[model samples]
Target: MRTSIVAVLYVGGWALFAWLGDSWWQLLVAVALAVVFTQLGFLAHDLGHRQVFRTRRPSDIAGLIIGNFGVGLGWGWWTTKHNRHHANPNHEDHDPDVSPAVIVWSEDQVARSSGLPRFISKYQAFWFFPLLTLEAWHLHIASFKALLQPTAKRRGLELTLLVTHFVLYFGLVFAVLPFGKALLFLAVHQGLFGIYLGCSFAPNHKGMPILTKEDELDFLRKQVLTSRNVHGGLLTDVALGQLNYQIEHHLFPNMPAPNLRRAQPIVERYCQEIGVDYLQTGLVTSYGQALRHLHEVGAALREPTREPTR
Candidate 1:
């Protein structure tokens, strides 16, 4: 079957579940939809990076429209930051999305984010949105910084695209469902989207050791050490968009999910040949690893020895 057909089937099936799931059985289906939306989030993220389709314009337009509700955040803004992420996965100065230091003091930053905003930036980094759209907020800030480059001015376009995306997208979701239902769904969907974003972005270099000032950036080494593969089950791959095989996706971002299954072996072989670590596990295992890493991360920052001297 064509990948497009498979995609439509998966998406269409979820729509059915979401619309008609009035019985107790719906909860089970809701769990399935949660997984599907996460995979969809990955595909949309892939599409945003032009790793899925050959032509980028249509994908960009679709990303602006279809992906807005889920991992939408800001399309134009995300593209810019995503490129930087791929380039410098863990560089503290370069990568704005994830910083190990965690203590930020920017004169330019608006009066030290506090209250809800501070909570979101610090603790909510993994789950700013149930639907992962607020990821655009992170992406937008990163993109705007990238836009500051004399060559590329993208901040304006990013905002315009996102605003247009909001009107059309929320318009449709609420148009079909009740206002209360829409907000509720938005809360739920965005929350789950946040879950999807958590698994999608965090596994790649988030909890891993930070790069040194002289750390060399090699392709396979970076993919192996910095990336991880989750879940081996077939069903998990379908719904999770091969996010379980994150190392493979990072190595070949253009490979589709189906091909990603095959690509894993090839990547594993190369990693083995080079004696690099290939972290592969079941879905729950990977999730636990990330959670544990986050805990370790929090503790590491809080250590009395590690704390900055007054």
Candidate 2:
């Protein structure tokens, strides 16, 4: 398959770079590796959604190999989390992606916050991209933690693959490069990996409406209203892994990445016919909208705390 061939090429490239190690230029390889890992993540996403394979068994096998072995991400854990996000894209309560953690997504969450999270929420919009540099580490940690949970399926297998990936990955870097350069390589690679991956997903639903229990809506409206699409051509499609068409992707989660673009016009027209709001914007505009929303949500935190009038 084409995907398999491309994956092989990426691995070969990494091997070649590893062999040619001990130069500052390896930092560039780190950048390329970050992009490579993100592409693997996209492929894993497709496998998770059964876009590539008809049966769950084949999909799970490929997902585990590509996700855990290839990208050092736990496929089981990611699928569990991602499935919940798809089931409820922007639901403040149900969606783990939007749930109050480091950054509060909703004003209600802002009220309940305290300590470090509260401080972060105050200027989350400003801190958003910078914070994304750590997103790779966050995901890696979360994946390991998920494997320890009782609910994790195939715990042994996933653990083995994950441990092996870290071992081989770290061993290779430290083996070939000096300790200083290895650290530098890791910083650049993981930081850019997180930023690039975060950028790809951020524009999908970040600025869109957040739903609550009281806000009842049908499936069609729920997905279309909460999702935003980015307008671009082939380059954009390849870069974002077809995620630029978030509305169509959300509506048809199992749709192949390539087909999502084809489905976009038809989906857009139907939404128009039904008088549903179809949100789409350019890439930079989409980030601006998301950041603006974050700023607006954190507005209350920016106000000086009032003292009791006694």
Q: By TM-score, who's the top model here? A: 2
Candidate 2, after superposition: displacement of residue 118 in Å? Answer: 0.7
Which lDDT tens digits does candidate 1 get at residues 204-302? 555554554577868767656766677658777655666667777777766766777788888788878878888877666665665565444434234
* Per-residue alpha-carbon lDDT of candidate 2 for residues 153-238, written as tens digits (9 for 90 to 100): 99999999999999999999899899999999999999999999999999999989999898899999999999999998988988
Best by lDDT: 2
What lDDT does model 2 reach? 0.90
Q: Give the TM-score of candidate 2.
A: 0.96
Q: In model 2, what lDDT does residue 96 have?
A: 94
> Worst lDDT window (10 residues) for model 2?
301-310
**Candidate 2: where is the Cα deviation over 4 Å?**
305-310
Q: How many residue pairs clash in each candidate?
A: 13, 0
Taking all chains together, each candidate's TM-score versus the true structure is 0.68, 0.96
What value does the lDDT take at residue 87 in candidate 2?
Answer: 91
- Predictions: Cα RMSD each: 6.1, 2.4
